[model samples]
Target: MFKTNETQMQIHSIRWLKVIDPDQEYITHISTQFSIPRNFIQTALDENASARIQCKQQATLIMTHLPFNTSSKAEQSVSCKSFAVIIKDHLVFIISKHDHPIFDQMIQYVEQGPEHSAEQLADYVYRFLELAADQFIVASKSVNEQISTVEHELLSSIKNKQVFKLLNHNKVLNRIAISLRGNSKVLNLLNDMQVVTGHQAAQHRLLNVMVETDQAQAMAEIHNINLSNLMDAYSAAIENNLSLLVQYLSVYVIIAAIPLGIASLYGMNIPLPLQEQPYALSLLAGLSLLLSVAIVIIFKKRQII
Candidate 1:
């Protein structure tokens, strides 16, 4: 899907180009229309591209990651989406692979409108970046909650399935952490842009964007460490639990073998002395029971159970 919105500000025009799941045909059309490089378009279209910032063809190309949804809720998948912010021909161009909240907000903010000049377009850019940062924070919160739930489940019974779920959380947090790190760099570039931070209001907005990006980065880092530690700690704990169970089973077998050995000897044909006794059956049964009880009592005294 693709949509275009153009707002003619007093000093410059604001052209917000939003694309979602663009195919080859759509990418080609937008590339030719905005004179945006095909490489930039292709990179944005790729699902696994790394976060980056580049300048090409007299325009600033800002490509970074955003959290995206997937089909499965249980999986809680988080993938990266790319967006480019380019200013050219007295217009601002935002090229993205998916339709995002920032895109909608910018479109409405300009259409209905706040009054600003060509230079103030930086405010729009920074605001969008701020919202993008917020997305990461939001995702981290959800991931943290899910991690807590999985940790609880692991506590009750450390199953392979639960561990896998925790592993998935680890992977997701790593991705988010990497994304935020890259974005922190890209956002720093915004601070250096005179046009983006020319006015006081624009400057403040840019600072807020930077703060949000930092907060998001911090959240990702903290949760990632937590999840990693959790998996390791629980893995060792689970092994210890298994070891205790095996020890108990070994004790049980040793105690049980005593009675079995006594019964086996009585069954042998060579046991003629016991067979000749009038109360042989009663004596053998009594002897087996007494020995089994003694073994159990000895184990108890040693606290083997």
Candidate 2:
């Protein structure tokens, strides 16, 4: 029953159980072994779950979105997943669908640091939130870099690919913004709750987490607005370029049609003015050229080109 890839460690005076990508059967086993609320675990596993906190009996459940870098080093994009933390008196169970680098960082910090030895389960929760906020900051910086790259590329030439890239960045920013708001809500609730306020240390840590959460949220919002404006400007430029191209094409078509209309009269069976003249072909050619030039001059004076 314990054959799964779950990592159980002793952090300070509490037992930390980290479960990744657990099956329903394993979740049932964990729920039975640790007496955790099964519903909390299920809620965390949900892909569409929002950040929230709940208390049931002796267990407290904290759900938060964990942001991860879904892009490679050359490119930057962010994606979020929900994770659940169930805190009992001496046991802390963290359940998520996938492992995050933040978890490893948490373990390493606890193992190498002496200051956190006296930390409680609530402190770890705050630390997790702070780390998550830091990830958002990193992601936001990456987005800013990407926007610069896209702008440079657009200056050279605009293409469908660049438009798609902007749309993709917009989508990522939207998700990050939403996740940050949810995180802020959870942090606010935790800060006001008696469970955190009663403990001075925990309250201080919670306040720090709250500050980081707000910063991340603000960054996301600012970046999102900038991205929206960039997209709008790009679209307007593209439309203007297309309109200019059509105007030039129309000017050329009218110039060409003047020559064609003059030549077409010679095709008629009736006695045309230059149809029988010995120098008619040369005169007609000169007339067409002259008329085309005049039309161009008229268009230029009107600023149609």
Candidate 3:
């Protein structure tokens, strides 16, 4: 689906074109309409695409991954997806193969008001960038909440299942960290090069985007560190639990060994002092029980059991 929104206020010459899961026909149509390279259109549709920026002629293609809520039945529950914002001539093309909430937010933002064309392109692009950063912040909050929940569950019971879940969360955070960092770098480079220079308002918006990107990068970094630390702490806790279990089994074996030795010695068919006595069987059994009790008491006193 294609959503075309043109500001009637004439504050900006740039019109916004948002595409949702564009098919080949849609890609071809836009490619021909804006003279954008077919490769650019195809790349934007790619889900595995990375964050990047390139300018061709008067058209600039910025392919970046945005943090998204991963509620899909797919294997990955948390990850970033591509969001391409192409500024060509007098229009801005936002492409995505998936219908992302961030894009919906962008759509609402574009349609919410009308501004003069004075610096509409820069304004629109930066606004979308800010929205993307906002998405990252939102995604991180959910991820952190998940991490906290997992941490609580782990504290109650150290299950490897939760470990696997934590691993998935970490993978998600890792992706976010990479995407945020990459996007921030690209935005910083653009700022230094004055890629979106012109109207004071647009420049101010661009500066705001730079700040937003920095904040997003910092957020990603902080969460990644927290997740790493959580993993480390929980991993050690799991190992400690296993070690305690093994210690318990070892103590049990030692206690069992004492009773086994006593039974074996008595079971021997040798002519011993109590072998001729009528109460020899009961006597040996009593001795065995006493020895086992003594061993249990010793272990308990030593706090080894």
State every prediction's TM-score relative to the real structure: 0.80, 0.79, 0.79
Q: Pick the candidate with the highest TM-score.
A: 1
- Candidate 3, clashing residue pairs? 11-115, 11-116, 11-117, 12-116, 12-117
lDDT of 1 by residue, 152-180 (tens): 87775635777788888888889888888
List, residue by residue over 52-137, the lDDT tens digit for candidate 2. Answer: 98998788888888777777877667787788778877777777877888877776665564544434556766777788889888
Query: Relative to the unseen true structure, what is the C-alpha lDDT of residue 173 in candidate 1, on a scale of 0 to 100?
Result: 89
Summing lDDT over every window of 10 consecutive residues in candidate 2, give the lowest-scoring window.
110-119
Using lDDT as the measure, name the better of candidate 1 and candidate 2.
Answer: 2
Model 3: residues with Cα > 4 Å off, grouped in runs:
1-14, 72-76, 114-118, 156-160, 256-290
Q: List runs of model 1 lying over 4 Å from the truth.
A: 1-12, 71-74, 99-102, 105-113, 116-120, 156-159, 195-198, 270-297
Give lDDT: candidate 3, residue 135. Answer: 82
Candidate with top lDDT is: 2
